[model samples]
Target: MKEKVLILNIGRCAWGRCIFCGYSRENYPEPNLLRMKVDLDRKLVGFEGDTLKIFGSGSFLDDKQFPREFRRYLVEKCKKKGIKHLTIESRPEFITEDTLLDFDGIDLTVAIGLEVADNDILKKLGKGMTVEDYTRAADIIHSKGFKVRTYLLVNPPFVDDIKESLDRSVSFALQHSDSIVLINLLPHANAPLFDLWVEGKWKPLTREKFFEITRPYANNPKIELDVETFRFVPRFPPEKRANLEGVSSEILNHPHFRVWQEYLCDWYEKPKDKTIALFLPCSAKKPYSKSKTHTLIYKTIKTLPIFKNIHRLVISTPGVVPFEFNDFYPFNAYEWDERLETPEIKKEYIKVTKKRIFDYLKHHKYDHYFCFFKYSAESYIALQEACNELGVSCTNCLSRETYEALKEEKGNPLFKEEALKELREVLSKVKQKGT
Candidate 1:
């Protein structure tokens, strides 16, 4: 049995001149590429257990010269080969009744890159369509009985109201589509917008800010949100690095630390109390075995006299001990075994982790549980469910996956320079505020 994957670079974009897009910038041999892809499809046709899938970079339906022929070829081949699924990407302007007709009787899903719902930001990004365009396109796709997926870009550069923009975007997608794929903007070397970013004219939201904007949509059942990391280069100056170096130390001396200390005086912090405890995960444990932030938090909590009178808890995987904090609840790492090498073991580990958290929360209650660790779909789902069961408020930090993606994309020499400068400015502010 053999499986075949075919990606067609069908030329032409519906919204060809989008400022932030560069999909159509690449050169392509349309007919030749289609022939090559078809030949590949034929090669896999003989295999009894084979599957075939077709997709393209630009708007698949907008390439009028070749897309129709390719679609026909693909549908016929798929029908003959009993293919599992066929997928494609397009813009709102390209999705219409005629476009949907092309996929008739084919097991296909169409995805549109609806970057955002804010018209002003869309214009800023040079997107060629409006929210109305996406809504209409969604209706057309749904009417034709095809599953529709939308691509959403969060915290785009130069967006002043990042939170409001994301909120509106999520609301629009939830109202119109079945599933949403959320991605952070990753500027590439050849991308048109790279120059703007490199010049410090554009910037992605900070990690903390990203989480604050997306927290509301984290647990929505109607929409399936998948986060894709941006790819960028890292470029930070020496001064910026120096400023960020001692942030944790300075935070330890802040008033927030004082408030945390007062709550720690009490064994249990209640939900009705003014102070709320945040549970964070610590994965790094070696030598003395302590989380840098956890240690800093403990020190800060100790300084806060009000912490003794409020509710507090540290939900963590067993690794490091919290310093003299009796309110800490240590949950053994469900997947601690380095020897568990199989997929089944990993699945069991996740199941065990979910069960442990659920079981523990069933008996205990908290006022607010803020997750200040790497954001993961599984962790977010589990924590949300736990919070729901306890009837308490729960929130998670920004998706680390998104941050990593942006870092990879922004790491280029051009964007990196600007990021370095911003980091330096932020650090300077932090130092000034600290003093």
Candidate 2:
């Protein structure tokens, strides 16, 4: 049987934050009953397939996207038009019995984006829903006498073991889904996974890998392989992220910035030693080592006896970056100044930074945590909040009194004598713990 897919617009997704979603770049018109009906008529003019798969920019069951009246209208229209099977996509959260009602005469299957099985990996992709969420939704759909189609993403980003993740995801999907659609994760310039791919942290799955991973499901009638997606997985280097002319506030507000922040903290493996972690603010200069302020801070930090075991990290615009990754693509590529950002962007920065810092500290244990930044900096606020939540003390190199004293200074506050004095005093108190 021939299959026809219709890509419709539904204004925006309820959760449009998936790192691998290319639809984030799309701007859809607000869903109106009359307008959507007209658009659907135009798209259905030449429909000839026995199976019709309707894909909206987001969930088809979302009332904001498809009103109840329009939804009933569409189902009746499809039945009238002699369409035998209808497939529609929706996020698991929207798969309630009320939403799935009124389509008794038609054969309907609700497709859900159940990308992965592991909750940790799902969080890294910013999927916004967990495996359990998908399971619950799937059970509801099945109980309502409707079929569930699971969209499985192969070789998603931030996964250390590709085969294991895919294997787990496929196994989990099989148990919960009546049908499985295998999609090779495609790279989009506007998506977060693209940055990870560009930075060499992730790569596209090879044809060999795809075949090997999907071998067990080859004979299953329910598994539908999406061969076309693999064709669009760009293998060439992405030119958009590099060689940009100058730093602008727009770059910091982009979606990739948030993804970069989440992945940076998620992927980092802390050092084995129970060493002191010294968090410093990023500089406009690339690699941070090239910045004059960072150079002076490094010089001063080296003088401390505990410095021998201290691990230096930058609380950068892209979130935390270890000193060793200073030369990495995003770490070295972008420049940011909190002053240039709008109030909204700055507030988001603080929220994202705080969560990331908390998550990083939660996983990566350190004997001691200390931070040296301008007392009034955004990173300082986030670090303080994160440390407080963890019940761990993070010594601030620049004391509040010193920040008050130097806030109005002509030069950078970091270089002032009082700030350095505070740094020395704080370091002196943190005795070097045995490695």
Report the number of the highest-lDDT candidate.
2
* lDDT, candidate 1, 149-178, per-residue tens: 787887677677766777788778877877
Summed over model 1, clashes come to: 30
Which residues of candidate 1, in runs, are more than 4 Å off? 1-6, 33-54, 205-215, 221-231, 234-435
RMSD of 2: 16.9
Question: What's model 1's lDDT at 209?
Answer: 46
Measured over all alpha carbons after superposition, the RMSD of each candidate to the real structure, in angstroms, is: 20.3, 16.9
The candidate that wins on TM-score is 2
Q: After superposition, how far is residue 28 of candidate 1 from its true place, in Å?
A: 2.4
Q: Which lDDT value does model 1 have at 420? A: 31
Candidates in order have lDDT scores of 0.53, 0.77
Return the TM-score for each candidate structure: 0.48, 0.54
